[model samples]
Target: MIQELNDEQLERYGRHILLDEIGYEGQLLLAQKRVAIIGLGGLGSPVALYLASAGIGQLTLIDFDQVDLSNLQRQLIHNQQRVGQNKAISAQQSVELLNKNVKTETITTKLTDDELLKITKQHDLVLDCSDNFETRYQLNRICHKCQIPLVSGAAIRWEGQVTTYDFRKNKQPCYQCLFPLKSNQGSIQESCSQNGVIAPLLGIIGSIQALEAIKCLLELPTLAGKLTIIDGLTMELRQFNITQDLSCPVCS
Candidate 1:
């Protein structure tokens, strides 16, 4: 039998249950779902917080780095006091504080190819909040192999982008398609380190990533196979239709 929530959860999630789309059934589904976020930096911060606040039953956060003063600008979940603490632990603490009912698992080790498969096997969805291309590529491959859905987001300078690749969904492009093998060899690949990002820019992108993950978990309208790009400077937003590539090595 499916476990029913107690009075506290019912009341706490009353607003969500009130939605016709996310009525009692949807809220219950969310409560039973598990999600994993691979990075605990700027984007992962908001993703974990919002999901926990929304009463996601289980969240696994992975990050090898510790908190630093430089991260406070956009990594909203961690504070000055948390400096020197593992980011995964800090994010888990933040989530627990927001909602004690939510369960958090913190992995303070860098994710390797083997570890990725082992850990992600049990998750319902994976959120790629890592800033590096190598980690992103690894996540895409593993998730594709395991047939898990992935929601990825990136922010640098004034630009932010969010996309969901549901490999289970027929003909959906994986992250590798958008970023082909040829681009990986490029020299001008911009990153947060090279081109500084606006502080709130991370928040904007991270929040959207969380939203997308939530929707994906609840099996609602998601950004799967679509890219939503936002320009923080001008506050302009645009969505592009994306299709799966037949020759794409990752998912094809």
Candidate 2:
């Protein structure tokens, strides 16, 4: 059943309704969207906030890690009071304060393959803000298997990268196609804990991820099949076309 926007809804989302790309109808479409975010750190923080701000109907915030004092520097969604709390729950609290109309589900435990698939299948899109390759690889496989769209983002030191893997079609290039597990790439874990990312790097990449997600939901042109890398120091942005790896195990 389609829902007519009430007066308060119209007022709350007035800015988005004014845009040509996201007018009243597009705002309504966004309201019907269901999104699952795989992390609640720096990257997931902006992604969740912007998605909620855009009136995404449902959001599932999944993160088993707990927030620490160090996270306050970059993870803007959480505050000093929420430190030591599970990231997903903390993020949920923040989202509630941001938009009452948005529904949020928090998962604090590590998910198994079946559990992850079930959650991913329930959402219209998935965003990978995870720090490790294991989680990224797992999500890539699940999203590809379920034919769900995925927006992946990562930041380390002064560099960040973002891309969308549109799995709605067959033989689409995936995250695994970019960084395979068989090679030493997956073994070399480069995370914020070790590398220390700049504060705005996550924001730049995650914001783009959110925008790409919105574009995907609106059936507009997105960063699908393309990789965008950013250098925060130089402020240089480079884009590369992402093609399917015929010999890749996941997509091929």
Candidate 3:
């Protein structure tokens, strides 16, 4: 279905239109894409907002959390007035306010294996914005099985990481391939909530995840087989090539 961009859409996406890489055709592709973002907290906030502003047609958000006073520091999608409301619903409100052309679907319950498989199959891409390893691994597993692209991001204190898992491409590593099990670095095994992350760090990682999703949806070349790591303190970014492990339980 060809969607003619009205005056409002053209005005809203003027900068995108100016980009040589993402001309009118790329913009149209974005408008027809659907992305599922798991977790509407710090990371999901920027990803959802950017995707909506960029004119992504459909966005499915899953987060069992409610807006809390603590989340205000980093989770920009929710406000004090929305405290006690579900994060997914609050994020939906934020996206709708950003751009009415974007459709938002809020899932208020925790993501289960069955729900993850079903919801992931319906989207062109999946954003693993959740804070836990279990959630990230589960989303990657489903995406790999369904041959859907997955974008994963994380931030803690002065460190951050973002990667694209394009299972549709052979020999590309999924999240589980890189971090098979939870890191033994901490008692809880590297959770953002417990480890603490700088407020702006989420913005950096989340925005990158959004960019990766856009690139993946438009079939543009991206950081599919590399893990991009960031150091917030020094503002240094490094890329590590990742290869599919034949021993990986998810892909092997």
Candidate 4:
């Protein structure tokens, strides 16, 4: 049951409501949507903040890691005082501080396949901000089964990428379709901790992830079936078309 915007909400989101693309009705729609963000690190930080601030009714944050002093470089949702706190809880506190009206749920442990499927079924959308390919593959499978839209983002070194998988649409590719599991098997995965990413690089990619999530919720144009890549070194942006693999094990 979506509620009408109160006077306070109207004032709080006046700029969004004023936009022709997202008017009063759109604001109300945003206020009624539920989102689940997996991983509370660099990418999840801005995605959570922007979504909560944009008036998302509920957000479920999932992460198993604790904040470290070293995370402050890119994880903006946590502070010095919160070092050692669970990342999900830290992000929850930050979201509440930004917007008390938005409800937040925290899952501080790794979720099994069944657990992930059950939780994702209850949300309007899912954001795959997890760092590892295993988690990303699991999320892609669950979201495809549940037919939920997924906004995926990744950043390493000076390169970043973002894409959306609208499972509601037929013939659209899932994440696995783009990068097959066999090809990724036994591959060396690089981490920001090892390779080092520019602080603002994650900011740029994560912010765009938030924007894509908003557009998906608002039924605006999104990067569905398209991949957007960013080269922070030369500031070059490029887009590539992604097609569904007819033999995709997950989505076929």
Write out the backbone clash pairs for model 2. Answer: none
Off by over 4 Å in 3: 182-188
For model 1, residues 1-252, the per-residue Cα lDDT tens digits are 238888999999999999998888888899888899989998998899889988888999999999999999999999999999999999988898899988889899876799889998999999999988888889999999998999999999899999998877777898888887666767335578788999888888889988888888877889887899999989999999887777878877
Using TM-score as the measure, the top candidate is: 4
The best candidate by lDDT is: 4
Q: Candidates' TM-scores?
A: 0.96, 0.97, 0.95, 0.98
- What is the RMSD of candidate 2? 1.2
Whole-model lDDT, model 1 = 0.88
Give the clashing residue pairs of candidate 4, or none.
none
Kindly report the root-mean-square deviation of model 1 from the true structure over all alpha carbons.
Answer: 1.4
Whole-model lDDT per candidate: 0.88, 0.92, 0.88, 0.94
The C-alpha stretches of model 2 lying farther than 4 A from their native spots are none
Worst 10 residues of 2 by lDDT: 179-188
Residue 218 deviation, candidate 1, in Å? 1.7
Q: How much is 226 displaced in model 3, in angstroms?
A: 0.6
Kindly list the per-residue Cα lDDT of model 3 for residues 144-201, writing each as its tens digit: 8999999999888899999899889887887877876645225436676677889999
lDDT of 3: 0.88
